[model samples]
Every structure is written in structure tokens, then in C-alpha cells.
Target: MPGYHSFTANIIYNLAQLGIPIRDSEFFDIQTYLEIVEIHKNVYAGETPSRQATQADIDTFLG
Candidate 1:
């Protein structure tokens, strides 16, 4: 399968769509935010308060 393109490491692909830049640093703590979406991927199938997924995300960023 070789007909499309790819991306780099775990980095946010669609910053505009995600509306990440709009989040205030005082609220979402953007300073400590480390988006892990496989580089070109911008789809994280989960919610923020979802313990199952958010916990892992927190662990990854805080750890």
C-alpha cells in the first residue's frame, strides 16, 4: 500500500481543527500540555473527563 502520504512522530496534525491554541493557559494549562496524536493524527477517540483515557494522557504528560 503506497498511494498516500505520512507524517512525523507523535505531534498534533490539525491544530486549527482541534482549537487547541484558543485554550487559555490559565484554564487548560497549555504549558504542561503535550499532545500525543501520532504526528499526523488529530483524532483522539475519548473525552477529557473520561478516566480510562484521560488518566493515560495525564500520565504521559505528567510522567
Candidate 2:
């Protein structure tokens, strides 16, 4: 867990870049953290389909 905070910060930064807002409290929540990780995985993937799917997911999550 040495680089855990750094890793989560990177994920939060990426999400912010994508217009997703994350609260400081949510950072330590296992479910929310996992959800963010899953979203980040798809959004940052090299495949077009994955990106497209993640975009839809982001839209839904935000709405």
C-alpha cells in the first residue's frame, strides 16, 4: 500500500480530466475506488469500443 495514495491521486486526476468529480471522502471507499478504477481502465484503453462504452457509462454516471 506504499503507493496507494499516489495511485488513487492519479486516478482522480484522470477522472477530473474527463469531467468526473470525486470527493475526498470517496477516495477511501472500497466500492467507489473500484468503480473509478474500472471506469479509468475502459476510458484509457487503446480500443475504440472500450472508449466509446466508457463514455456512455460516464454520461450515465454523471447524469
- Poorest stretch of ten by lDDT in candidate 2: 44-53
In model 1, pairs of residues that clash are 11-39
lDDT top scorer: 2
Per-residue C-alpha lDDT of model 2 across residues 1-63, encoded as one tens digit per residue: 989999878877766875667765454666876686688688668666533467778899999
lDDT of 1 at 52: 60
Taking all chains together, the TM-score of candidate 2 against the true structure is: 0.35
Measured against the true structure, the TM-scores of the candidates, in listed sequence, are 0.20, 0.35
Report the poorest 10 consecutive residues by lDDT, candidate 1: 3-12
Candidate with best TM-score: 2
- The local lDDT score (0 to 100) that residue 45 gets in candidate 2 is 84
Whole-model lDDT values for every prediction: 0.43, 0.71
